[model samples]
Target chain A: MISGDPLSRVLYIDLSRRKYWVEDRRDLFEKYLGGTGVAIELLKEECPKGADPLGPENPIIFAIGPLNGVFPLASKTVAMFKSPHTGNLGESHAGGRSAIAIRMAGYGAIVIKGASDIPVYLSIYNDKVYFRDASALWGIRSSHTVGRIIREREGEAGYRTIMRIGRAGEKLVTFANVVTETYRHFGRLGLGAVFGSKKLKAIVISGKRTLKVSNAKAYREIYDEIYKMAVKTPAMRKYHDLGTPANVVPLNNLGALPTKNLTQARFERYENISGEKLAERFLGRRLACAHCPVGCIHLAALREPYEKEPYFYKTTMISYDYEPIYSLGSMLGIGNPEGMLKLMDVVEIYGLDAMSTGVILAWTTEAYLKGYISEKETMGLKFRWGDCETYLKAVRLIVEQPNDFYGALAKGVEYASSIYGGREFALAYGGNEMPGYHTGPAAHAGFLTGSRHSHLDSAGYSLDEQAYVKKEELTPEKVADYRNTYSTRYNKGGIHKKSSREIRQLT
Target chain B: MVKRIAVLDVDKCTGCQSCVFACTRRYGEAGVGKSAIFVRSLGGVERGFIVIVCRACKDPPCAKVCPTGALKPRRGGGVILNSEKCIGCGMCVEACPLGAIFWDEENNKPVVCTHCGYCVNYCPHEVLGLEEVSTG
Candidate 1:
């Protein structure tokens, strides 16, 4: 029954020293707010300058907003670290009980530092912390299996989130991601690789709490207003219906959907992967983040069998969003809808960043086709356009690092392109692979300056699309202003020296 | 005469969690320990949310075993807590099958829903609304 602001509490775990501690950092929460604000500061403190991105010193920071558990739309938890893939600021936002559970579990943030000598999983139940041995679960290929295992073993199934990594992370793939709740992920910047480097496997967090708020009347009023916007708004309705994949056809028509490694802006066979077509042909289920009214998560069921076995088959539920479709489908020339879904499924099972993996595969395909790398390099797999099976096989070999050429592929698109001669077509800004938008220069600018270098960093792509396609207006200044405004609002890491009382209260 | 635990529709709930914060705000704090209402996911986020609350039963086992007789039944099915009489032995907390009994360790008392319906006022989605039902 902690009183006042529970934001003051912090849970600390040491993988190297294998020690844990609790501290309070109320001042951090009071001033900077929560989520990205708190995580950046914590990252700077724990991450030594110029340290290895995959080293234990890199530090994994999960910060929840003050509004989480209290307000809607605030359920997102921000994950921050120096990305192994980009070697720069790596960040991703996730829902699905991650943020709400973290806040309610009686901690403002959970910091994992140092390295574990053996594989392990951390379970947080109420005020208790259990470091369970994870040797049996080690080397598992699918991220889904890891989540299913933890859900059954952990207490508070409905209330907990099992955040785990797959073979990609365990194998230290630079583009690996940390999967939560089987589907949602800290999907970019290689948080999964960092987890693997530390020999850490998974984290299960659950808590039932009583959070205090400031003016009960005003709180309810604001809450209702936001809730109304989410349910009744056309913006939410669009996502609810088709999810983000709805943008496929429209972006393709606008000549903004990056395709064939950005050599062509519009994917010629866009209808094959359009959101409308998917809903009509394959949409099996729609899911949402925790408490989110907009069920934008679209799952398409694809049943495929082993190439050698005629009788064996397995049904794969693949999650697809706008960026993955564009980066993996259009950009890689995966015009076949079923092929795109299979690629997406492999990416999820391997726990790699779909955008990064797609971009990397696209780079490899083009590079191999142009004779940059021949049969001597690709192990004799003819990497051709729309050859999804070879690309999927390439993804597995990238994790295994079967060839010296592919050892570099696991790094990321930017690194691969730099060594292999496709910088212009690399289509990556800030070292991380680009997301699925080619609206204009503002999108590039957002990637350039956005701390996380993400499409959502400023919604510049949306601004660019709306201007030229929606309104038929080409105002670069307005788009630039949009980027600047967002960067300032969310660019939270400041070198502020806090008083001891405040720092102790916050972390 | 509100007598039933409010049910929320996920199709209508925009994931605002207004009910949760409202419960805590009523206590003038910023943590979930004081919140009587909780909103969580069914499994993965793709599944949706389940809002757990006090059912406000007619025969609340919480009131029946109050060591200090602090948990008294209101005119409605909901129970009221007399903090002054509570010993905070947690008998009521264990007695609750709904897991709705809130313990305020700082005050050494149990927190119960008085059916004030403060959460309903904040519910923007109209997923929650007070319906007066007859208590048996």
Candidate 2:
């Protein structure tokens, strides 16, 4: 690490007091090397043990690594908080302008503590932090509109990163996410619920500064090498071509897609929602992170007509990935690509973590089918597989929380299943909803034991696939040991893995 | 032979800011404090990037507006700065409609594109390139 290559300033904001201060935490950055290292330490310091996840005490920490503005592919913002969903270590990562914007703003880590009394948004431009009133922007229908309104209001365009939540977050839905840069997110582990608890509606960060490199020539050489690798590598090409939704067909064919509450791993009508089909039909745009050249963020153009007028139509740009397609498409047994996109749109609009929302809805659909839940519990709406219209209604009910069952459903599948008696098909591992993969036993075991209890925590699905390919017999202890060693080595090396989100929970 | 940094295709620009970083890197920096080129989103990224660089204009207005004769019309369409003569006035910045002249706050000088074409190499999408323009 170059001396002062990544900024070591930590910005501490107390929402309760509406006071802010800066600390030169060079020691923390030096010891941990930023990102998860710095964030975990900050979380430990600010978040009390056994603190209420939605209380005023829980701290939200965002940190970036040294490679943030200096290199390609180091574009992740690690968000750590006490998870309302899992009630433990809440860690999630998002790639957009989040890390770059934060790093450029000259901070290795930002610690936001205490809860505010009213709705507000934090606008951090260079060295100044402004607490703006967001009373009017509070109850917007779509998170996209919130982003648009803030984007216009802030007027930073390309320089700023806007992170906000939708109605799900305002209502404190446990699996709600913080959407950043429109498409990207601090997606998993209920970061939005934490934001809701703090009454922080949005955060806009922008900055410009010149960083010194120990060796400029060597830095250029290394940057070129990484940039070349990113564009040329076939694995990265996969991301660029069709985005993550490309995995739909292959995972479905392999019986690893995790469809319909895991009753089947393969979707019968997988082609309709496959990456090839979606790109061929509805792909509207592709976007990249600040430093990354591989433009992988794919948005689908979903055009629908107004109910009153058949000729008038509106086209919505909906972002899609493998996890969402697996959860909302196959997991919900929806064959129509448009149907899947509509569900995804609602999830984004509500700022719900699509994976969790899908899994919870899948569980709800199965519970309804099995007579474990009835129309009374579903608020007189029958949830059938592939019926996105009914699922959309359920999502609205969840955010609205009209009754006890809907309120429980808003918490998460695990809590809802425990209350409603569908633990067997709830499809939650360690209190959090399961990811899209059903590759093997290690997948489940890793979810059960991993630090964050997330697929990205250990990437047991990758290990399972690797083991199957090598024909190796693996024990539970072996998987745990492998996870431990990988985490330790990568944590020290500062090597980030997209498959495992290795930056988050290395400790 | 007058070389100009021409934007070949704005649509292909990914707004990765590789060009921005590369331009600043020429002055021995790793970030975007002093870059002659600017790439901003046209509202959102879906509309594509606005690659604002020195268009190598004929009869450059920036050179005319400089009070201290710091900026002189180069062989190409843009202006070359003599840092020693610069008074750090705001005239040239307002003169250019493209906003291609980036201010170096630390040095108290205007950092204008000299058409070095270092950024063209860094742009993976081939959105920018150097072209020999007629010095009319």
Candidate 3:
């Protein structure tokens, strides 16, 4: 620790005024160790008590940890803001080039405040920053194209991170996400929508600055030890082999897959979307964040044919994990890889929250089936299970906010159901949609009290599973500890075998 | 028989900065941020990362451009800067297209790769490794 690392510095960028300045919050970094700890303080300082999440008052803060550039699995950057979706604490963690780029750019954190009158993207190079024109990129349907263009023009290749929003974000969908490094994201609670509200579409950071370490010799020894542990350890092996999709079967076997929006806890079609099946059927490649030995992100090879030319075929590589399967597969009762991949791709294109999007679509389907909504509300497209085309259309409509019904759905399951008639299985907590877990009351309670309303908050979902596995009763006190730990997010490195997500819990 | 080259692969990297810290820690005894090797993310994280250090080019451009001959390529791999002979003229920074060389503003001298391969061991993703490569 550099007692006061130069990164003890925080840069504030105001979009409304198109001005920027640096703040040396040495006190915050020294106390918090960066990331979530710093982000919470930044949020407190930047967001007004009664500020609208989508208003100019909301601030977006990005923070990386002390161990970030210096250690493995410490590559995650914590993003904090007042969520446009939840109107409370919005935090997300993403790996890829974000942490390293931010660190190398020589700052502990970057806080973005106010809204821009025109669309702009911030480019930070060594000792200088530029807000470039992003007018042409405002309506691009494909997030991939935005990345390709930015990568071609960016600085410090392999040393920069380009973060941008897709059409869903530009459209101001409450659940829109910002995509970075093709596969990583600040993926929850409408950070992208906030970006859209500010007329800010993207952020590109680059640097090659050096950092000082406290003990080089001991650092080398510890580095080697962790490297060997990463390669051989079971905790990381599961992530390396099958990635997060490994959860599909185990959760199913436990009768906790959240099939059809929790109409049932387990999905009978589990084998079709199982991690093993996906690895065998479509796993094309695997990749990891910078410096992490465990390549946990899995990409699937989705081979599709030309609709007009039956013989013509094109293969696309799509990233998949347990979350997508839960949100897009069983949650919607679709197990076919083709439909799942297409639906996932569309969700990515629109920049919507895949989990929230899937759960909302599922609720809409159930609502329509129960006659809560009619043809007039659906805008003629029947909300059906396992239909990729309609599901993709629904995701787009959410981005477009085509009607009042879809507009409410975009708000989230709980809010959407309040107007449309289905709170019993609305599948949301703290105004955010539920993750793909329904093990017991603890999972639900975790969402209700979990600061970010994220499944990883306290991993109370695992508590539900643990109780069932041990065949013992869980007292309310035990559950409260789990919820409190989740609320404080202060567990001292206890990520374990049962819930791998405990390792990557975002603030 | 001491053969070493920093081995980097595109496949196994997770874009983590463990190696960056390890490199910095090597100099951390005095302070942090003094490591020879640097690892950062390239573009968005999903696109992957860029790990920067001495590649130990067969005919080193950095050494050739140094007016003081401060940069010297060692046998094992990479160039080590001679603090005694060095003027902090940033010619090597401009000359080396890979941009691996670093001039510590605080130290007022040019810094390049020492090629101890300590950073390789720090890379948990196996993105960095020291292999034997002979150019003789």
Candidate 4:
């Protein structure tokens, strides 16, 4: 029922003093728009240069766009923080109830700063912000359990977003992630580590507020147009049908799918863990973001025995996306879909970034193969591709940090490879792990130069494919220039004084 | 003959809440509180969704329980709300078996599905359809 400009309210919470305040930052919202734009400006304002990414000074900012509550695919919440992994601009986008919940909560952005003395979780209900003690919630083995606990305790059923991390984040793993709604995540560049550093465990957000639009008729027209296109479009239909894992076979066929630690672009056993196979065999359910009609989040029901009891079994619903499939299945040489799901489940339980974990494990496997470090460094365990059991153990060790090697691995592939050798095949860009694109030089250059060094940063791989079809010769310099253009356009974060006409033109 | 929103395929419901938004938009507002139709997860999304909507009962319990005679059985199966006469006692919200009675927090009124089929148009999967029923 609360009205007015919901997009202008910026909520800031200081964990150190347990204080919360709202700022009317109309300038930032009006100029930058929202989501990435607002987050970037906040990140610049709060995160000082060379500030410790894990320090109390580093801020955690979550922003949702103006179109978030109103539009379908505009369901992403952009998280900006000084990454403990990358040591640079850390930006990750997650689609869940996160954006919608935040938007409905009557805020364009929420910034959490300072560190808490004890473990705690933030619950924002309408105008109230409660810093509840999360001492019991801390050290929980499974993030899934944590989510369930939060869900049971929280009042709002479908209208809230529960974001939590597990032992990996508690242990401050640089590649740890914050899982939201069990399936979606702020799953890159160690936001979980930052949360751990702040002694913050989880955040539950829910609100019921009416949003105002300039023109309702135009809005409805635009909404229908976009919705029709999104539902009927072939590209989006593919996403809706098989979800993102549908890209596996096609990317492999095109020799662009990174496999076995990027030693090969095409995974030979791609069909075994392909999207079609997974959908055919184990697709339990398909889910959409809060507003998105494209149900791209595919869950695979993994049933396994209790090991001790012959008849006892548990069916675990594990969510799968293309990046996770590539990182956990193809990159680590996991041919079996079940094994891949198991590994992904483990990663999710521990709240580790699957992509970073896979890349790190791939580097270690290759390192072991090259005799850089033996069983001694690996805590007497053999590292091999397609061996998910040992990989699971290794992932556990990374979170537990039982040994120095595991401790190094917890820092991410770039830092781990730098310490233990095998830097050549580390498969990391800007200290973050590489995505599943092995398209061309432009892709690599985009990864190298993109602000967040993410495939999503510029989608240079698609451009590379376009250039490839046209037989356009793209040098490393040209690729870098192209990437630079994107960085300059989107990455330069600041509050720009612009005329209303200019803003209209830009929109 | 009158039409009602029918959840033809529950499995096709992805829990997007587009229908909820679409329904609320009919009131010239944004958000789901005012929407007559509701979509929620069954424990978790992996299990599935429960699409809550008015089934247009033959002998509507909501109309029978109304204290102010605000809710009256229409020619069809559903009930029409007389906002002027009604007190927001929420008796109808509890009387419904399907939990389809949505409370508009701002106005303090029971917003039930009018069977206008606005939400049916926005359902991308065609999981929702308008089915004609002859009132006896």
DockQ of each: 0.30, 0.66, 0.37, 0.63
For each candidate in turn, the TM-score is 0.82, 0.94, 0.88, 0.93
The model with the greater TM-score, 1 or 2, is: 2
* TM-score of chain B for predicted candidate 1: 0.84
Top TM-score prediction, candidate number = 2
- What is candidate 3's lDDT per residue for B1-136, written digit by digit as tens? 4455465685556555555555655565322246556655454444455677778787788878889877877765567778888878789889888777765756776667666676676565567787777757
Tens-digit lDDT string for candidate 2 (A1-507): 567654789999999999999998888888998999989999999988889999999999999988888887788899999999989889999988898899888888899999999999999987889999998889898988898788889966777899999999999999999998888989888999999988999999998778888878888888888888887665476778877776676566546789888899888898899899999999887778887888888888888899998799998888888889988889999998998899888988999999899999999999999899898888799889999899888889998899999999998998998899989888887788888878687778867888777776666777665555455676777677775523333221111234333212221
Interface RMSD of each: 4.3, 1.5, 4.5, 1.4
Writing each residue's lDDT as its tens digit, candidate 3 over A430-503 gives 78888877667777787788887877876777676556655557777878876543333332212235443532
**lDDT string, candidate 4, A208-307, tens digits:** 7667667778878888888889887653766778777767766776678899998998888999898899999998888888888887888999988999
True contacts kept of each: 0.42, 0.56, 0.47, 0.51
**Predictions in order: chain A TM-score:** 0.91, 0.93, 0.94, 0.93
Colliding pairs, model 4: none
At residue A478, candidate 2 shows an lDDT of 69
Screening candidate 2 with a backbone cut-off below 3 angstroms (N, C-alpha, C), the clashing residue pairs are none
**Best DockQ among the predictions, by candidate number:** 2
Instruction: Write the residue-wise lDDT of candidate 2 on B27-90 in tens digits.
Output: 7777777888878888766666798888877789999999999999888578889999999997
Give one digit per residue, the lDDT tens place, for model 4 in B13-38.
Answer: 88888898888777666666678987
**What lDDT score goes with residue B77 in model 2?**
78
